[model samples]
Target chain A: MCGQNMLDIEGLVLRRGRRLLARRIDLRVDRGAFAYIVGPNGSGKSTLLRVLAGFGRPEEGVIRWSGRTIGEWGGAYRGEVAFLGHLEGIKPMLTPEENLAYRRLLVGPTGWRVPTPSPFFDASALPDLPCQRLSAGQRRRVSLACLEHSAAPLWLLDEPLTSLDHDGVAALGGLLARHLMAGGTAVVASHQPLPPTLVPATVLELGTKR
Target chain B: MNGLLGAQLRMIYRARGDYLAPVIFYVLVASLFPLALGPSPRLLSLIAPGVIWIDATLASVVAFAGLFRDDYDDGSLEQMLLSPRPLELIVLVRVFAGWVSLSLPLVLLAPLLALWFSFPPPILPVLLVSLVLTTGCLTLLGALGSALTVGLRHSLVLLPVLLLPLATPVLIFGAHAVLLAERGLDPRTPLYVLAALFFLALALIPKATAAALRVALEV
Candidate 1:
């Protein structure tokens, strides 16, 4: 459903309550671009990513996906964006498989579906075990499976490395690289530098001057 | 979404405490009238409809607090707003499933609770019907309450303040239906009113809830 349309942000302003976080931020990332959103704490890295994700609206901005404005896209905007954040977005009472399966269904695709475990996440480990019983890392992995199953063209990740072990990080990085290779766009908010292999196509750094 | 509904269904299965709390509260509150008012059958029967209705309303309010809190806590509310379906559909399905999972127990136990209030066999079916329909009204309204107050630290205090005003009319219609049934004064009119309220609430409240949830999560 997407062509080579680039994501464009023109003269954006981001704010939290009364405090202005970023001013007149303009950026452009072509389709399939991997843009690392780097910023110090309180610098609005997450806020900018959120605007792209359509999670929370910014104070003022114009964001377009594949040449369509966010407002014009309406409910269909959700179809193209995948957002994963620090909260893991998994229900504690649901088992990993159940959570993954349910999230897949949440996007409204039809036909028989099943949760497939990823090497990064052991969602297959005790498929019936509720998320509350899983350790923090394990639960985070289950949440990662939600990301793996999504078909959206745009990925917005906010501090997504939380609670992941070394192997999990490698697995995720590999997936990110693969997603870029497959012509998907991503805006990842993280301080960690990308592995040399996928040195992100561009860097969108956010923060007011010191 | 069927996926959301299935997940919600599984969620309630694990939360035995949440499911059982309202029924226990319903019983305890129903039993309170007898102790406080001195167990005269006349007084008990006279106040029975209001007592059960009030308890049910209170139980529904309590049940709704957890409804959207989890969405906020786990950050699923943000994702839910971004679901491919409109936010209204998500709120509708979740609220309907929540009503079934949490409040339906109270509906099933309504007859027994009514008996405690001296509801005779003749009025029992009407009482059940009233409870079922009002349960839908309160739950839809409560879903709106839950959405509007989702992320705030003080949302619990605000919930009742927001919900009670909306809920008062529904309760009156529900209780009056029971009273008319007890007196055999052609309870059909109030019952029809209750059904009308139910359908209106079903049609409209979820859209309001979805709007409120968007404000809560996005703004």
Candidate 2:
């Protein structure tokens, strides 16, 4: 278990358009650990999360997951990583239950028969209408529901707290605790602080920290 | 794979407009030929094969214009990119779902189109066979064009223009196949060529489309 189950980045340089964002960054996060990416607006936190999720290429440097380069791991690596971007990844035409069921099918072996409701809401209380008819906070909860059924080991979440209620935050805190305890690793990019129940192993600030 | 297919089919069902556009467009364009050319059965049947082939080609363009644009905009394309399965297989499933929901209707409507063109009843099966192969080729090729333009703003205006030239070969062979059948000839030569083109697209286009999608996500 020399390289073990961990993410290692070295001399990373990332950019957006013509402007370079961050340079010479190195970090590591082990299994059962959490890393928080924080910075002000336009700080490349989201870009870093995208790179970590294997969506974008770094301008310079190498990222190794569990001792293998992501290119080498390829689909095997993607199968283990669950990504949630700013768009929330839900179809507006499908209900919350339908969304969660489809998500579960993609990441796990579950059939779409009986979808488990979002833990953030009452089981019988979710509206049967399409998610587009729901409020912003409700849609965010549905997006968070993907994390619950994902069963993916590495969660790369960007702005998971964008539109959640107090109860939704608490439920997410609980879910994160369970995932970490089960030996899952998470890399989150957020403008606000996560719930107080869990502490991050590393806080990597992007751009120029004030 | 079954799960992806099921979810995709459900989405296709929910967004009825996307699939319906091609079917409606095909029928409307095919009908215009009979109207615009005057009602001589000899003249209509003579040009029927080319007219229907062109209609299918244009319909395919409409069908595949937004193949990946919605997913790209909504970030589901990003999620699909991250699926554990090979991207090529995922792309193939998507194209297959599109073919079923968008192009199958055109195949089903063959008899009506044949009737309108005064095509002989005996040639109906041949026409259907040519359509199945031609549409499959056009859809696969259009999926590649769609993938390349997924992240661009003007993709809708550009897709058909780029695809029509590339699709010309399929149109020629498919129409020729049916024309031969109408002339009471074997029609096997052009039919074999259409089969080859369809199989070639089947073998190659999904991989290319998947690669294009990966590039689209990068920038």
Candidate 3:
């Protein structure tokens, strides 16, 4: 019921052994906004994104979605968020079409029986025949396709541009722009600047430790 | 309703190598015992129960090695944990898929293997039924073991060590069912006990597997 902000983190801190990955970081992403988290390796950019995706707990401080704590949202509310990490999450053995169908089945609306049988189910439209056989860029595209059908309000992407070629990057940039233009919020962790169209986006940069 | 089950079914069907390998291994392992025991009908029949049970149990363990490994490696496990379905229910579906891919085929081929051992036809039904029931238990138990050892370096060895003891009752009842049927006596007691073990594992292993996955993921 609480729909104030899409995401909010306050006094968040994360530590690995004696080292601080992120220290007392306060960040917020309003509904429909595009935000980028930038940092060098080991600067906790991925860690921050993972925390917001609800994949990890902050050692200190709190993360709130809408107006409630992340843990309080329950499974249904949490399902409204999709995450894409650096690793291509597609199953290597599954054809691109099957991978997309499976992902849709995982996050799609209820009563959505698969083998969706729609023209969109064609594997040819996908970047490759199957994920394992695909080029790195092609695999990333397949994963992106899965993300597009997620129907989630929020997207948490970590280094999504890593293996993408020029065209692939532009295509992804266009998708993110479209997503934000349609009132969806996104938090991206990447070193590259997205296309200019994805403007009005906020940037949070983490400085190197002394 | 369809979301969880559909994802599980796809995972099983698409990973043909992971799914089929264990059943083939089961048949090969079971077949070896008879060949090693030298085609003596009496000896083959006498040891068939033990051979089949051991092979089935070992096959369950082999099949489970990939249960969470694929998901973990591909990063799908995190997505699954974060999905709308309860982790326990999702774990159950994964176990169900594992059973179908690994144990179900074993059950179907069990009778054919029994024939090679000259097992009596009357006892064949009991052998098949016992295998079906016991495999269910092994699948559930194996799921728990796989979840616990998800990221461990020695999970290949650890899984069997963890699961074999828990599978003892299943072996006992399954073999007893064959023994009773061979004498032309009703094996109802052992059959019921095996069924009960299956149901018990079906009821409880999901929660245990879920908890184990949580710990494994955190580590």
What DockQ does each listed candidate score? Answer: 0.65, 0.61, 0.43
For model 2, what fraction of the real interface contacts is kept?
A: 0.57
lDDT of each: 0.80, 0.84, 0.78
Off by over 4 Å in 2: A1-3, A110-125
Ranking by TM-score: 1, 2, 3
Model 3 per-residue lDDT tens digits across residues B45-86:
888888888888888888887688878888888777767767
Model 2 per-residue lDDT tens digits across residues B16-67: 8767977998999999987898999999999999998888888888889889
The alpha-carbon deviation from the true structure for residue A106 of candidate 2, after best TM-score superposition, in angstroms, is 1.7
- CA lDDT of B57 in candidate 2? 88
Q: Which runs of model 1 end up more than 4 angstroms from their true locations?
A: A1-5, A110-122, A125-128
lDDT of 3: 0.78
* Pairs with backbone N, CA or C atoms under 3 Å apart (clashes), candidate 2: none
List clashing residue pairs in candidate 1: none
CA deviation > 4 Å runs, candidate 3: A1-3, A17-19, A110-124, B1-14
Weakest ten-residue segment in model 2 chain A by summed lDDT: A110-119
